[model samples]
Target: MNTIKTIAARAFLISAGAIFYINPAWALLPIQHWTEPSGAQVYLVESPVIPMVDVQIDFDAGSRRDPAGQSGLASAVANMASKGVMAAGGDAALHENALGEAWADLGASFEANADRDALHYTLRSLTDPALLDKAARLAARQIGEPSWPADVWPRDRARWAASLKEADTRPGTVAAHAFAAAVYGSHPYGARTTEETLQRIGVADMQAFHQRHIAACRAKVSIVGAVTRAQAQTLVATLLARLPASADCATPLPPVGEISALTAPAEQDIPFASAQAHVLIGQPGFARRDPDFIALLVGNHILGGGGFVSRLTNEVREKRGLSYSVYSYFAAGLHAGAFTVGLQTRPDQAREAVQVSRDVIARFVAEGPTEAELRAAKDNLIGGFALRIDSNKKLLGNVANIAWNDLPLTYLDDWTKKVEALTVADVRAAMARKLQPGRMVTVVVGGQR
Candidate 1:
């Protein structure tokens, strides 16, 4: 009987192509949302097609919230969360080893990531009742009671410091660091890890940060897969209840101020030994909830985000062969983000490449996308939308973002319609309003000084 069940599962998966592909025009699966009694926001999508579950929990505790002079504190703490935690007052290393064995036995995958605005913890496990329970318990402990093992701190901190030092040597890294610093002077967004800052980090610091920032009030939990509403409610409650109900000790992160309008274009060049020059351009862009976001999204596809079909690629790469690739995007955050165009070119052609890229952008901003380009972008976006949410894991990521950004529940449902309604005029007008070529910052690494 067991062998028959296993064969049936494999056959079903093979026939169904692993995931049920939804038509781009269909409404996205409904998200069941509620707040746990512990104050964590919960979003769920019941998917019974596969006997698996994915859970992602996010906290507003990213590097942006790190204290002054503590550049890498948040990242270090996030990394250490999985190393070892005090569970049941036993040896931390032994506890972590056992937990690892348990996950291996249950075929669970776990990960933690920290970015500028949030820290994310994710778990994927089979929905077998016993297996699910163990995975959830392990995740809860990692979230609520990080042990911050004394012995593990030195090794983790050293590894992080070494990685940062290595990254600083790369020209692309140099350009990115210089660009972010120039764009966000004195803001926490400009924070970068250094040997000095890493030295200041310690296990105690991580413990304190965890206490203050990893509270239920700051959490947004997203769950997807084979689970009932009652099961989801119980699971989330069990997980989040381990965390503090409120941020009693956290110093609130200040809102990022608007970028001041540039009177003239800002330029920076860092000499490096390389055959190709790495270049970056543009200025501050809209927040996540900016009304012009959809228009800008559609327009950027024409400008550069649409791969070989983009204007930047057509002019810079295909037309003149100045570079192999060039692209632009808006890195929207909780606060004002950046719009950037980036590329690499032969050292001697760096100046010309920047000029051509800027010219392409200026033209696009002045006239917007052509009717054909607008239509192509919308069609491509709408057509590819289904792949974005075709799997349980992918859908969980989208649901998490929606919950974190406080977007309307209908955001996913309305995505295609929004893109479809955008006109050439809308794209042109939005680009002209949001992007200013004259005020942009330019950074080049690895060309003549």
Candidate 2:
């Protein structure tokens, strides 16, 4: 059978155009949570509508945890994991080809990736006991026994570095690197992977980094799909069984210090030959843990995040026709991440576009969204809230986010209520507290006077 046929046959045999009705109560579904014996935090949302299950395990070993000068270690470790697994305890090692075939045969998939804030392993498998049991065992082997294949890193590293080299030649890449450096300063978030950094990493380094960080205690596991609390518990145990136990759960990963504030306005006009100028503006914003999250979320939508309807787009893109798109976002994470406003414009109108965008932001921060804007933003956001958790993957992401940020279980259910309750004054107050328009960093690339 082809992949699609096999997946349906294995996971669930239903209609071709199956209408799986997700009960509205599912949005308010209680997130079942518990701590595994290994001290890993577990969050589960039971959706019996389908026979497939989605699982994600997060660890505090993202790029932020990379050692100084080893900028891409976490990513490298994650990528190297699928190359193969080392042999352990009577099961002869499976080569990469064998491993791929095993997963395909079982009609399941596993993936690993490192993001700015964390490393994640996600598995999607049928709830069929036969398929799920084998998938779990195979995933465990990949997670706990990544071979860091000696032959793989050198070839991968060469390709990676060459790609980075090619990317550096692009104007957007140049602008982004500069913007990150300016906003983040000496923080790890500013660190970029370079050919030199890759040279510092090797197979041994990946092995060492994985051993040091991939402990059971640091994992926050999120599950959504067809599984009971008991089954999830067992699954969690089985998946993490081969991982090194946490040495100390109470003592957290040493805090990577927060991004410092911009004390003075810094402006850079990078000369490039590109046709359109890339302009980036703003400074560090709030953290995920900040109580002002809801206010900021709503406020940002009115400011620039809400497309076509935002103040920034209206002011910078609509009226003057300076650029096709203008937007802003808060990269809130474990610490205060960057609040970035960006757009591209004709080289001649770069300065004007930049000024207009900044003016809009300053006004928004000072005066907040107008009552009409607030009403519209709320209506739009609240109306679309259901779509956020409409599917298994989306719900899994919400649960994982809730788990990662240590949010209350009712956070999703209460999301709309909070958004609706927000007043223009509330958005203004939060924006005022978190932003200072004057002290922002302004970057203009490929722009001329």
Candidate 3:
């Protein structure tokens, strides 16, 4: 186990009589990192508090790498990596053991979020040295040597396809699909995996895909647990040793943007389904590297990202009583992704809710946040910054964001100061530059436009 450091917080009262905290100077929770011989980027932070370790490997083999006409190929490759990789024994025993321990697990996931960049594999284990070794080995094997059993692919494909079919009947999912396509027409980020794509994928295809995308250079490794810096390095090296050399096929990701508004209305009538409707509206916003990232984050918090305190929630739900909830957020992915606003309402209230949401967004674009709103947003953001890095998992996530986005090391340290210094002018300027109400792509599900 390694020594863990504590972070202190200092609080003060603002003019509005609200208590807020100034950034505290705490011992650095240093993210010790190095590139493995195989070229995999490795990061580690030790916490002796709990006898557990969480490891994540992010790859460039996201949806962008999918072949044309095979919209969901990238997802299929990511999903299949876990089905008895190179090893003979299946995941059955592993699954049961995970349930028993309630502490260890492994998974392969593809997040095809618009504008975001990578897919990832996550392995978690208890501090027991043996368990940690086994988990890391298994993760490495899954990425490096998936056998893709012929017998298993059929069952997995059938189940996955059926789930996709089921989701197609849901209005919320439909709206999301349409909105993504409208926002990212020709860009790979907009592609949605379908049943046909899944059916066409074979073991060879997955193997080839992994070989090309899951290179050491593309891997972003994150670790947080009861281990020292030395142990962390050994763990990463031992697990990733088997991976093949980096491939020359890796390419820089391209940016996605739209000059005008894109709109598409998709209607689906699920026989005898419930009496509710869902809608989504959005457009490309900012990348993680944007200088105004924090500014927009605070702005979105006041717009629709924050729950009760956001302007969208207040106007759409509290003031007019239109929908249960309405929220907006921007995801800074490998490229700049959409700024999305979404809501759900009773069938009868759908139109009113959509109208109200648009009206509020338009007003926000024009007026930005008031001085009072800016003050509250700053206080809340600065005060809450501590909570964001309170846990190992969260700390690992922060490190991953920093490494993946190529951000400065001073980011986390300077977070509060950045938020605290934001003024009305900053928020208003960010709104004008990023928020695009008229150009937003809107999708209404289970409702007539």
Candidate 4:
């Protein structure tokens, strides 16, 4: 294992009437793991570097699990969860005010977000014993006792619908929605929030979705910073214990259907009034545990993931000056996600930009990265690994991903070794096997339809 050098002397700090030791070398921090009686998996990294603790709790309760025709139910639930809970013993407004006051007194930060495969609630608080206790209890109450208050539903729904309306007017948003619908077809992954779908959602729908999906069995907790093993365990257990102790949360999501091979390249053109045309290209990519994950990750960096040094930038931005920015990425999700290359350029230049990007991708798939490019990618990835987990917040996010995806505990520890072992041939073989340029779907918004 590659170990980061440790500090010869630890520094001491004082905050809020408490003394704490800061570890300068946090790269080697170990993740401690365990399970609660309620079947919630917990991963903790005890770091005393800061007198703060960060907790992230995730459940398999995102939009992918939404009932047919209720596309935004999960997002609605996530948004309302922090607003109020039944444990506060009041109506929606009262409970919301009470929770806000409680969090203010404890000086804690809380956030919730929903994506395709999961819903997450994150909390950050000073690790002073009193503050930590209060924060943890409040977080638990919010998670386990969401009220989904009926009184607030209309207002919240209106706000969400209005936001969607605004987003729909943007060319990039229109293109993205169209691209997803075209790429995934009837798969649940293709579902996007529309005015029609949002109108169909009721508070009862959100409540039912929460009850069926956010159970203890599907929870994953990640805690980091200024806490002991016992404290972390208790924190996670307390938060999740109130959830339904069922064997499973809900029926498993159906597999995303494979993208049909393209007979002719697919394209969608949406006319809009904008200075530049927004373009999106490519197709379904890979899942979290794809065998070619590491290779794809490294290869993507060389191709487009690396900011200014990427081939996409070299071709579209640096050489031809087609756009100010161009990039590509494989969005790995619970199922096969999209591998997309996106850029915005002058209306007249949009088609040429797309062609240039495609040419770059085709050549990359055919020839792969050079020996020097592969070495640079590995060195950059390995050398920068420390920065990725240097902070407690960063480590907590990584741990949450590992837990949610059922990745090996040593995933972080083994990351360097895996990248170091990659060769030009590995990247070539993986890209060749996974990417098919001829079958990619392309979407352009803002140009002539």
Candidate 5:
């Protein structure tokens, strides 16, 4: 499946809730990190349990780098990558269908996507020497020699525009779009992909974005599988060989500013005909790099992140029956992301539901959680830590996170301890520092009268 349809599906299809704990012997091995000769930062975990390899290469070319008029440029570029690779040396060019068949023949696969903070390309293949070599070379070409077939863009653009129009009809999509716009203001994080924006993007824009933001030096490669340090280095060198060589991290690219903080509370009420009103309440949360990240984690659990056991669920769902489901979470990333509380109830009860959620958040942030609540939060978080890295893909993701955020190499092993070390006072202090109930933005789409 060389097409964007199949590649995008594989990129986003993540499994949830492992039935067994992640094996400490393999998953918990200390990470080995170093800078490669090509200037890409590499993090490796040698787990020989399976004769397979999973590699994720991340670049700082996510949606945040998209041009102003082309909000979906990064995503479009990543999708076009799978269309095929240009020919070079003595080899003939391969079409999308032929390229997909090449990977299938070798029992290997690759996928690419753009998240809020980075563009991710993942390759998976058996550790067999011949197969691995073919997979790596093919992946390198896709990363470096994307053709951006002109014939493909017109058809794909129309498909994308139609898809967005269909998705826009849902209230949930409308609510999320409004909430993001209100919370992120001028930041690129708030940018939305509309039919107009998609129409403005062409194959030329995709090629330009790829050229400007993608380079060998900007790659952060994370590998988890049966590979030694020397082997990994050689593999990385081969993978990035075709890309443009440029200055490393020492030479900064265009700087994306930190998301601006909100000044006063803003509320938007929209009119719609629906049985249930979609509600979103929140403000900018801390960045993943924030020193108080550990404290914020534990506090959010006690506040509303925990499912049935959270304060939001207890007050808004069980206590008042205002909504059947309510949850809160922090989307911390390179910059401060949104800390949102979302729920849906009858259109008439939307106001009460929003008010109840707001009150719960204000009280939790102001007073912090109690001693008992803190213990429970810690217990739940620490108890299920193993489930987070149950598979090779999950382990690769965590390694990638640590690498991208410049987190300590021991971040995974220290996660439970950090959660366990937090005291009630620490949580309270961190919450007080990170959240401002008075300045939050409230967004209700198809809900508020």
Candidate 6:
């Protein structure tokens, strides 16, 4: 019976060609749309096999909304929401009891990422109808009405401050923070939370941020899992009805202009540490909606983007043995995000490592991938595409990304075809247009250069 099922599934796939990575028979369905009474945009997807459901509600309440002096308010608001709610009892017991009743994992965890235009609050859970009810109630109440539990503020703030101080002591952290500031300049994207920022994060600030940003007006809900259409509708409705009306909810996402070259020199003397130092060089790259995404994606694979076979890894690690690992990648965002090249090596070899990495990037940008590299990159990318979309978890993540970026629904279906369609000229054009080594922000931490 199992063998028959396997053969049938494979046969179905073969006949269905390439409509979907799984269940080719399952037609490409539009993202079911419905507006909640409260006006939150709801997106529902049905996959009724695992007898479970995953629910997500996001708000434009990202850290970008943090006021000038209060850089951590959005994070604090998100954190406090789940810790307590207006459930069976007050917030503390509400959280404790919810955990006792069923599994509750923090999708956003305790981390805070604030961009200039938006903030995000996300949660996921298994589908037990009863648990679903409780979760919706809890999530809605938290987003709609949150009161910071006493004493939690000072404790969490202390921990946050301590972590920031500790992160300052590490080379990698130093490089990342410095890179953001260097690349963004006076933009809010470059804002960093210091001890002063943390100290100024009052409970009133969190309340104010939550009221303004976590309102129903900015909500976008997505659910994809083992949920029936009826169940999906109910789930979305439950979430939507709990949010506020969409008024004045539009958050601004402005473009980041070209950033100046930046260099930050810092030293952390760690006793009894390895004599090696770490280096990171980067600059702002393309936005999520850039037309050259496919070209850059394929081209980067041949450059320092891919692991063992990347140009940077080959030149720095394999050829010169300057480091054990080196690589580069472009992080696409709402705005031009980051194009970062990273590596670790001995202090004495730091300068050589930085030079080689920069040279590789420059060459790739000037000439793009050779024909052979481009072909391999396309073939590898297209062939591996299925493996990337083969699971529910991966598909869910893809859908979230699509909705987040407002990508067309047909993106996944035509992605491989688009990648394979690129010519070497396309790659060269993309590389030249995207990567600028001289304008890059470079940071070398540890060991004397």
Error of 3 at 434 (Å): 1.3
C-alpha lDDT values of all predictions = 0.82, 0.89, 0.69, 0.81, 0.86, 0.66
Query: Model 6: runs farther than 4 Å from truth?
Result: 1-30, 33-37, 87-118, 244-274
Please write out the lDDT profile of model 6 over residues 1-449, one tens digit for every residue. Answer: 34433443453354345334354312244556566656666666676544345565666666555677777777777667655544333544455346433322321111123344455544454455544555555555555555476677888889899999998877677767776777767655677888889898887788767666666656666667667667766766665444456545566433344443345422223222435676778777887888889898888899887789888888999999999999888877766777878888888788888889888988888888888888888778877776665545566656666667777767776787799889999999998888776777677767563
Candidate numbers sorted by TM-score from highest down: 2, 5, 1, 4, 6, 3
Per-residue lDDT of 382-404 in model 4, one digit per residue for the tens?
88987787677888888888888
List pairs with backbone clashes in candidate 5. Answer: none
User: RMSD in Å for candidate 2, one decimal?
Assistant: 2.0
> Among all windows of ten consecutive residues in candidate 3, which has the lowest summed lDDT?
3-12
Ranking by lDDT: 2, 5, 1, 4, 3, 6
| C-alpha TM-score for every candidate | 0.92, 0.96, 0.82, 0.90, 0.93, 0.83
Most accurate candidate by lDDT: 2
Q: How many backbone clashes does candidate 4 have?
A: 0
**Model 3 lDDT, residue 369, Cα:** 90
Misplaced by over 4 Å in model 1 are: 1-27, 89-95, 245-263
lDDT of 2 by residue, 181-273 (tens): 999999998999999999999888888888878988888999998899999999999899878664555666787887899999999999999
Across 156-247, the per-residue lDDT of candidate 3 in tens digits comes to 78998999999988777777788778777777778787888887788788777777776776677878767897888787776666577656
Model 3 score (lDDT): 0.69
Candidate 5 lDDT by residue in tens digits, 1-449:
24433433332232112223336545459899999876789999987656668999999999999889789999998898899899975556887998888877766789999988899999997766766787899999999988889998888888998999998888888889998999998799999998899989988888878877788888999999878999899889988887877534566778899888899999988777777899999999989988899899888888888889999999999999999889888999999999999999988899999889889988987888999999998889888877788678789889998999999999988888888899989999999998999899888878757
Give the worst 10-residue stretch by lDDT in candidate 6. 103-112
Clashes of 5: 0
Q: lDDT (0-100) at residue 318 of candidate 3?
A: 95
- Measured by TM-score, the strongest candidate is 2
Show how many residue pairs clash in every candidate, following the order shown.
0, 0, 2, 0, 0, 6
Q: Give the TM-score of candidate 2.
A: 0.96
